[model samples]
Target: MGEGGKRKSRQEDAPAPPSHRILTADELGLLKVSEVPAGDKWEETAAKQRWGAPDKAQGITRLQVHCPDWSSDRCLVAAARTSGRVTLHAGSDGGDLGSFRAAPPASTSGRSDTSTNAVQALRFARPEGSQQLLIATATLGGHVSVHRCPVEAALSTALAGRVVQTWEEAARLQTIGDLQAMDVSSSGRYVAVGGEGHQLKVWDLEAAGGAAAAAAAGADGSTPKAGEPLFAGKAGKPSRSGLQDLAHVTALAFVPGQDDKQVLVGTAKHKLWLYDTRAGRKPQAELVWGEGRITTLQPQPDGSRIWVGNGRGHVEALDLRAAPAKLSMGHALKGVAGSIRALALHPSEPLIASVSLDRHLRVHHAIKRGSLAKLYLKQALTGVAWLPPLPPAPADGAREEEEEEEEEEQARAAAEEADGDAEEEEEQQQHNGRGARGKGKHAGRGKADGGSKPPAKKQDSKRRKQ
Candidate 1:
């Protein structure tokens, strides 16, 4: 064959390239953590390529990771940008998956528009028996909506999903607090929102007939029944000066194992409050947490530990099992030059990821003994999350089915052989019995011919004559 023909044949015989997905905890541990990349490198690589809008100098507003299940290997990372857009990125390679505009129309000119519905907080949740992930987002304009993200969204273009339900807060923007922070419980049954007016409220989605029921309730959807929240509390301490307290909640998170009843709240007044809905509307406990506003709170799976980040550039650990939940000095992580914006814990590892106003993403060992990795992004980062691993491939399932079928075939063949052997043995036994009977008959005939049979017949005739 000519050279061109041989090259074409070789190309056809080559193996296909591997598909990229989010890195598992084990895979992340294999990387060099201390080698920090330059800020310009992110502008050229992840920022421009993965996020698709390098001009969005306004940075990200919130980040969340969605996994169909804890055991699933496939995961998606969603980042809500200040441009009123939400973008999806692959967990494995930080590649652009897809994006959609979540809030009202806004420009991408690196300007923050106060009038536009800019996304302030977002969460990824999967309801029980759901095949897709639900993204709940709160905007600065007091708008809350739930959008359904299909499994195949990664393969589609920028607009990947549709809003399943939406509800507006009737409070005026100037008087009531805008929804600044929001969280959905692990069960995806409860959602809580809090902000500037020192107002905190929790909604039981399950009680509201769940996400499926709300979707059918129309675009206006259902609101938390006429101001009656499943749980509600205002954060702030009364002042001796007779002036109104200006404390507004800055961060909110549901306690992981508390049946969606326990909540951790952080306010602009440097306080942390824990509230249990089953107990009462008042906070179960309150503690002076930080010197500045608390920006984020990440609770452990067991709810015994919580990692907190603040505007003072500190990430501290709190032992919830303690009487008052004091911050542990030994576990305090520090080094960022700017305020810590968000914190995300690894699902199964001791690693924690954080993004800050310093425009850097840093991962550290949970114990504060080692730095795992750090990368610089040119613009300020408002949020960060560790994406889960991807799910098993279709080929793996097909292979499992093939092995099961082969085992079944082998079992059937063994049973058929055993039946055939038993039939042959039975036929041989029947033939032997027939042969033995024939021999006996022949022997009797021989005896009769030798006159033994005549003597018996003569005795019978004599008896009859007598």
Candidate 2:
């Protein structure tokens, strides 16, 4: 090759040094594009991964929050898995405190498919004035077990994140069919179990301890066992009017009414049935929603409304004002994409948390009526329960009263201000009338006295001031 041809090849291969380069430090916003995740891999790359990834844990089937002390948001979260394991976590930070293998009830000792009877329902119920928490779990094979777990003791296991709880059983209500759904009242007085048969078996938990004085004996004549029913009676029955073939009670919620008599039940036939335990077992009213089978029911804190989640990935609020009710799907939550598996309300904050088949946990603001905090856990969460909002701390009572007084004082001040404005308006009208009369008199005087001096200096001063 000739020297000229070789030099041209070398020039082409050599990197250019004449290109323009930055003379000053780059601004942060100038590199925004470099920080953005690829559109196709949105979830794979994002900034708001505060709770971290679900990869840190296994499939989270169910989760319930237990706040024993109402004054603090610090609470223990209990999560159950289809693998026959129940884990306790810190609700504030989602930190694992411990995980324990759930012991199958004595009757199911021989079965290998114990996992089939995984945690179907999990709730934390605190009896009135009780410091301890009652963790109720329902499984596939009709085993309903309750354990009395102390919050401090359970949370201390955070050091050994997988240690088991040694708490004894509080109550166990077993039935004949698969325990499909159940609910414990906020007052922790009644435990209603529903799956098969005409009505749900309602048990009085206060008398579950073999105490005959507190628990009246059952009419069925079954001798009460320890942590068993003091009295067991059917609490809900299928309505005769419209819902054809009431298949199964999918979910239950004891509405926090003026009394503990009303309970809401969801049926397989796309209906929300309200049963009054005080009345006969038949549903008092039925709301035929859409075609999707109702899967979960959550009541508002005030008991004025209920949030219903169905199998078709829809969530709506049902107003419980009238009988023979019909729920119109009005507030369908936005950005929800799969069958909703669970719904939970923040105990204190006005937020609603929901889990779905889409493997996402969404926390929504109740008033704003939109999804606020959302996280993808990559787990099919079946159920979620928030620890009831803490009662006002004793120290806060005085502050609350002061706030009420301040509000009352402000309202009274506003009323007084309105009155002052009304008086001022009346006085101004009177002054305007007097000025008009004076002007008329002055004009008549000017007509009589010929081409008058600009109405007295007083009128001029008043007019200038006005």
Highest lDDT model number:
1
Q: How high a TM-score does candidate 1 get?
A: 0.61
Highest TM-score among the candidates is held by which one?
A: 1
lDDT of 2 by residue, 249-268 (tens): 78788887646678888877
Q: Give me the displacement of residue 107 in model 2, in angstroms.
A: 7.4
lDDT of 1 by residue, 1-466 (tens): 9755654565555443222112211111111112212331222223212433345434566767765444222546667766666666544445556566565443458875655467788887766676556777777765555666555443232223322222221111111247778888877767788888746788766554444354445685333332356778865455678674575888889887778888888888777788878877767677776688988888888988888888898888767886234434248875554788778787777777777777677777787535655567555556565543333334544455567668879999998999999899999989999999999999989987887777899999999999
Which 10-residue window of candidate 2 scores lowest in summed lDDT? 24-33
Model 2 TM-score?
0.60
Candidate 1 displacement at residue 397 in angstroms: 30
lDDT of 1 at 88: 65
Estimate candidate 2's alpha-carbon lDDT, on a 0 to 1 scale. 0.60
Cα deviation at 458, candidate 1, in Å, is 99
